[model samples]
Target: MSLKPSSRDWQRAIADARQGLSAWHVWNLLAMTDIRQRYKRSRVGPFWITLSMAAFVGGIGLVYSTLFKQDIRTYLPYLAVNYVVWTLIQGIIMDATGVFSSSGVYLRQEAMPKTLFAMRLIMRNLIMFAHNIIIIPLVFLLFGVWPDWEMLLAIPGMIMLLVAAYPVVMLIGMISTRFRDTPVIIQNVLQIAFFLTPIMWKVDQLGAAAPFVVGLNPFAIFLRIVAEPMNGRAPSLWTWGVAILVIVLLYAITGPLFARLRARIVYWL
Candidate 1:
């Protein structure tokens, strides 16, 4: 046997990727295993992340509240929510770089869809996100911030976020597998994006420039979709529209590239 995959193999790879979504049990098991192995033999397990997140949020909230001259009652909860969501966004993007490369063993051993690895990565982070998010309710209670019905809007907001993140993960995973340096570059870009996006500070602080700054950042728009609802107000329709538009644009650019590169991933890895 030649062992070289043909054009039909590439098409099947793409088709398998789509089919992988329905193979929920496979990815879900792999994701859970990843989480377990990560925290195995650790005393506190994943709660360590939750504890560290609480401490970091508390420390930052205190200093920033003082510096920004904002009341702790309001500011801490805002900071907590922003940090949690930002952590999820940052983790997903950064980890996407390794979705293929790190799973080289499984790829070589079994006929698996690349999308399965992506889902496993996302699910692992979501598990960690679940652990870190317990602090949110605590912050809400401590600050006496009661979210209203508007908070339900966060459901759709989170759905939009995950939907947008999928293509980015695929694109980055493919590129990073090919270029060893891509992960480092992605980390640097994410660091810059962190400050550019409104996470630690309010967008309004930028004055008239706020609109221009926030308008260009899909991260900011996605953040607003979730954060605004928790803040007791629904995000504007325009924000939702912009987030969907960004998702569409990302898919448009990445879809063809991913199709071309899907089967070649193992070779690069």
Candidate 2:
């Protein structure tokens, strides 16, 4: 015979799990502290990362634009924006994988919500993304890529992406806590995904196969959602619909698991 958690026990666990949102200030502060400490002695601080990314994007854009025979005016801006967005997505997924183990000290010392740690990780990455994004406007100016009203849509697209990130962080964070090797696996997969995604390449270049390659690729879908707006066009309805559908499915699967295993995280750590 086996015993299951009673309804009240489950309810309490869920409530406790959701409490992380209310503790946003705690996670936000912790994330800021991490940024400060990471660059404590450095003169340039986090902007060093921004400079590095700028150099990378510039170098890659020059080479790829030449190789692909694309106009520098068009290709450089496209590459710059897409690369920044990809970095944000990649960083979130990679960092989320270590959220629990990295916060083990706090988890052991207190009864705080596990999701708080995940939020901190996401917040840290968001801060980094913000810094790295400064180059986009410079690229825009260099390439004469001006934004229009459609650019406003990028705001919602970004919000949707961040909203989608929460469930992904929770799902990966939970699995990583248990498996330990999950982070390594996720990193390897992301490497493969990078090439498959249309970051340095254009979708139309693939011709007839573009639909299957770009449409089926979630990262591509995500890239289009944010990138199209910056390019002065609203993403197709299909893009928004697919993005929302994927997020809904992700939450449906991960939400229950998070609720069920929210307490087991401490032991796993």
Candidate 3:
């Protein structure tokens, strides 16, 4: 006997999520609700992420700073900012893989636009990321490191980064749902990519290899454009150009394909 419903039941959830997006309020609420659910029943709420992050940077910063013979105060701020941005980058890329995976049951039981779940995944990370950012000002205060006026550049830079991340998030989330093994593969690869990128150190430390690194690694390029300006240095205009170009191209390429395949996504899961 066939188990699939005729039509109406399957369509309702998708319609609800879509209609909910109309006001932007429901979409934001869905995203916020997901964030809250992540901390539910936890004694510390979301502070766990913050506290763990603090310990991570402090412990590692002290060890590495001492080993490298760099002063703890200076190194701490660098590590803090780097870790914070890297946390956002790594978290989004890693969590995005399962945006669809985690939402599979929801999709099967309800008819939400599928994209709403993906957006919610992004939003959830964005919120925790904000919490984690508290690490930065603390580092600045402890270090007395005064950034150049370039620090103001973070406002626009971050806006650009978030806009740029959408394509990566959408493309990965959709594909990972279709291929059950994808999330695992991405996780393994990203772990390697993280070490290779300059999350814990300055890319310039690579010396002659820095240019080649930037040319070949989109993740590094993204991090550089977004983080450099805040560190009191302006990234090369060419790098920003390339980052934005890649973002626009990826979004254009993935946008329609996602819409076309959005329905089939449910079956794949």
Candidate 4:
């Protein structure tokens, strides 16, 4: 005799299967697809991100370091790394904010996952970010800079940063879906933030303005977790632990909150 499963059993099975599908795996596949789509008609493909980054770094490096009266060797890489990280942050924030709107058709018409859309945005940014990363090594080689053991510390630190960043992205995506004006406001604020945050010059190099830049800046707080290690300084264990802890808290709190609101998102749109 064949038996039919109860409603609860079907729901539980679906949940279990989703839980088993790792976020990392989803991110990797989505990221790859995003890169391919981004370069669909282009000859150079995803290398465009790298090429553009190189031009930006080279162009800005020549102008900014000259204006700042700093050496290009030291300043160029700093500018490149900072700009890459800043771009990724902006992409994540903006992408999350528009996740619902951008995927409105799919959300309304299809059975495809909502969380996957957000994940895809993050993954897409990461893939582009990785492509841009090629500029780092090229710059390093041109400048004759070498990564010491301290630089190796950046791998784990960046991993921590990515983990900490996702839930924040998801939360922003959910909140912005409820507020249509958020995207425009975010664009203006991001422009202001670009100037406010230190990209080309070190905070310490900013002289008296250093304290305000360090203590009050949210981007500074976020960068502290990853930038130091990336720039060849070993990140503190305490800082890494704190960043990871924050990630855990964000997931634990936002997961259920987002889930409850997930179904209502379509109505809002």
Best by lDDT: 2
Pick by TM-score: 2 or 4, better one: 2
Q: Backbone clash tally for model 1? A: 0
Where does candidate 1 stray beyond 4 Å?
A: 1-14
Off by over 4 Å in 3: 1-23
| Candidate 2: 10-residue stretch with minimal lDDT | 1-10
Q: TM-score winner among the candidates?
A: 2
> What pairs collide in candidate 2?
none
C-alpha-based local distance difference test score of model 4:
0.72
Each prediction's Cα RMSD?
Answer: 3.2, 1.9, 5.1, 6.1
Question: Model 2 Cα displacement at 75 (Å)?
Answer: 0.6
The order by descending TM-score is 2, 1, 3, 4
- Candidate 4: count of backbone clashes, pairs at least 3 residues apart or interchain: 0
Shift in Å, residue 152, candidate 2: 0.6
For candidate 4, write residues 1-269 as lDDT tens digits.
Answer: 12344555446434632642355576567668767877899999988778877898899999999999988888897787778777777778777788777778767896555666667777788878887878888888888888877777667767766766667666777778888888888888888887887777777777898767654665654566556656776655655655666778888766665655655677777
Model 4: ten consecutive residues of lowest lDDT? 1-10
Give per-residue CA lDDT, model 1, range 1-269, as digits (tens). Answer: 34445677658767877887878888889989988898999999989989999999999999999999889898899889988999999999999999998899999998788888888888888888899889999999998888789999999999998988888888899889989899999999989988988788987789999888887788789888988887777888889889989999998877667766666788887
Which of 2 and 3 is ahead in TM-score?
A: 2
Supply candidate 2's per-residue lDDT for 143.
74
> Global lDDT of each model?
0.87, 0.88, 0.77, 0.72
lDDT: the better of candidates 1 and 3:
1
Error of 4 at 206 (Å): 2.9
Tens-place lDDT digits, model 3, residues 1-269: 33343455446534634563463665578778877787899998888999999999999998988787777877788888878888888888888888777777878998766667656767778889889988888878777877688787777778877877766777888788778788899899888888877777777678899887765687877777767776677877887788888888887767665655666777877
